[model samples]
Target: MTTGIVLIILSAALLHATWNTIVKTAGDRTSTLGLVALGHVIPGLVMVTVLPFPSVESWPYLIASTVIHFGYFYMLGQAYKHGDLSVVYPIARGIVPALVSLWAMLFVGEILPAQAWYGIALIAVAIQISSWAALRHGVGRAALFFALGTGFCISGYSLVDGVGVRLSGDTLSYWAWHSVLHIFIVGFIALRRGNAIRALPRRTWMIGILGGIVSMTAYGLVLYAKNFAPLGAVSALRETSVIFAALIGFVFLGEGNWRRRLLAAVLMAGGVALIGLSI
Candidate 1:
């Protein structure tokens, strides 16, 4: 990856972490995630008006991605409900790069050199290290499973979008259509909650919507990066969001074990540097 691509992916990583932090701190994770999904819908609506429709070839990936994204959001909301940002976020984000990398090589044939592979391994290890305190103390069986589920959802979408954008011939169009599906997913959740959507506070609504915007932009950047860089490298770099999420958990959410998390963040930074240099 070029320096420009690295910077873009890193910016996306930060934004991704920011939005997840927002979700983790929300009053009701499910509802907040719904609002976040709504955030994707508004921009998607605008894009649909101006952008050309995606090609027939892209539709399969788009449809599959939409279904996968619904599951992703569900798993994420549940994970945050049952675990802290620092604990769940690292595991969830940590596992994705390796899975995405493996999928890319086996299915997409995007090969990475040994150096890049080393960087990916380093990043994954650092992320697991960051979660050591929680793991050592026991994060509860429920939270562990939910977090793992969230990671699986992330890996699913990463691979789907990696190919989906390239096929669409218009990156923005693919992103818009993929995001618009959020409406159905969020609407389904809202429906199940009855009139609770109306009862949600204005602040919660605002945060969710804004966080959704950030989340969309973050992934949009990643999709663009994938066009320029290897999918595995891009995915691994994006997982740096776990470190950012850890800091957000520490500084904002009042989570503990900052010393360990920060140390892990430093190691993760080195791993990212290696990935960038190797690229």
Candidate 2:
């Protein structure tokens, strides 16, 4: 990976973890989704005035991505409701790289080096270990299954966004429109339930908005990075945000079962290194 992509990935790692922690710790589904949509709303609405219009060809990709992201949101909200952050977050994010690697290999006309393959295997192991840490802490089978379902949704949309951005030729507009659609879908759901708008605390709103900004920007960066880098590498680096979230949970949320988590982190870092080195 180039220095620029590396920095973008690393920076996105922090932002990804930060926003996930904010949602897991302070924000409920309504708060999290609302803030996330708001994050896109502010930046996306402003970009409408500041940036030139995207090609008309980009519309289909934008619209498809929006639908996929809404599903992602629904699965994620349910995952958060049912599982621990360490378990849900890693498994959900972890599924993205594997499926994306397979998609890139089969469809994107990209070939992975042998070392990158090794990295993919390492990533597989890291995901297992990270998941084991959650189960070791007593996360049950049902919660684990829900987290896997959520991970599948994440990987599905991530693949969509990865191809969508590169082919669309306008990452910002793709994300911007996707965010707009998210606001409509998530907002509609919240309105129907009458949960988010009426009773959410002010602090949750603040956390949601901040988390949204961090999250939207992270998505933008990853989509932009995939324009020039390998999908597997982009996905791997993004998953390091799991480590960041783990640390955030430990420090801020006072989670202390560190031995197994440390092992998972090492495996994850090694996997990322192997992938990056293959580049």
Candidate 3:
């Protein structure tokens, strides 16, 4: 992967983690996600209105991506309801790249060079180390499982959008419409909750709005990157988001048991290094 694309993906990853951290700090998955999702729709709707619509070939992929993204948000809401940012966020986001790598290989007829394979392996090792702490904490296997489900959702969207954007021939329109549907799904859920509109806190709303903007930028960046590169490289670089999540956990959440977290961090760093060096 070119260094510029790698930087874009990693930059998006940081923004992704930043938004997740903001959501966790609020500690209200239902309201936080609901409002954020609803607010996010506005930007996408505006974009789609101004931009040309997606081509016919892209519709299937775009539609599929929308459903997968809904699943991602739903499972993420459930995961947040049950777990902390340190544990759940890593499991949710950390596990995606490996699976995406596998999908790309199995279905796309693409093969990673030996070095990229090692980089992927290192990332897996890092996730395993951090997950050990979760296992020890009696972290609900159910939550972890849900988080993994969320990971699959991530992979699904990545693969679908990877192809979809290329077919759509307009990355901005593709994402704009996809975001519109996705935000609507979440908004519908949020509207059902009584007082959801009235109960939103100004501070939390600000954080969520900021997060929404970050998320839009991240998704847009990835979509644009995929237009000119392999999905695997984009996916691999995106895992760097987990690194930011780990740091966010340590500094913002102050997760207990420093030793295990430190080990996990080292493993994640080593994994990224191995992947980078192999590349």
Query: What lDDT score belongs to each candidate, Candidate 1 first?
Result: 0.86, 0.73, 0.75
Comparing 1 and 2 by lDDT, which wins? 1
List the candidates' TM-scores in order.
0.94, 0.89, 0.88
- RMSD of each candidate? 1.7, 2.3, 2.5
**Model 2 lDDT at residue 167:** 64
Prediction 1 TM-score vs. true: 0.94
Candidate 3, residue 187: how far the Cα is off, in Å: 2.8
Listed per model in order, the count of residue pairs whose N, CA or C atoms clash below 3 Å is 0, 0, 1
Q: Considering lDDT, where higher is better, how would the candidates rank from best to worst?
A: 1, 3, 2
CA lDDT for candidate 1: 0.86
Q: Write candidate 3's Cα lDDT for 1-279 as tens digits.
A: 666766787788888878777776776666777666766687987897799989999999988888887788789878866776557766776677778888888878767777777776666666556546665576687788888888999998999998899899788888888778766676567567637645777887777777877787888899998886667767877777766676667777776456766776676666556555555
Stretch of 10 with least lDDT, candidate 1 = 77-86
Q: For model 2, what is the alpha-carbon lDDT of residue 15?
A: 89
Measured with C-alpha atoms, the lDDT of residue 273 in candidate 3 is 60
Q: lDDT of model 3 at residue 129?
A: 61
Q: Please give me the total number of clashing residue pairs in predicted model 3.
A: 1
Over 1-279, each residue of candidate 1 has an lDDT whose tens digit, in order, gives: 788999999999999989988877776777777888899999999999999998788899998888888788778768877886667877888888989989999999988888888899888988878778776777877788999998998898889888988888999989899889888887898898747777898888888899999999998999999888888899999998887877777888787688888887888888888889887
RMSD of 3: 2.5
Candidate with more favorable, higher TM-score: 2 or 3: 2
Error of 1 at 162 (Å): 0.3
Residues 77-141, candidate 2: write the lDDT tens digits: 77767876666766777777777777778877777888887887776677657557565677666
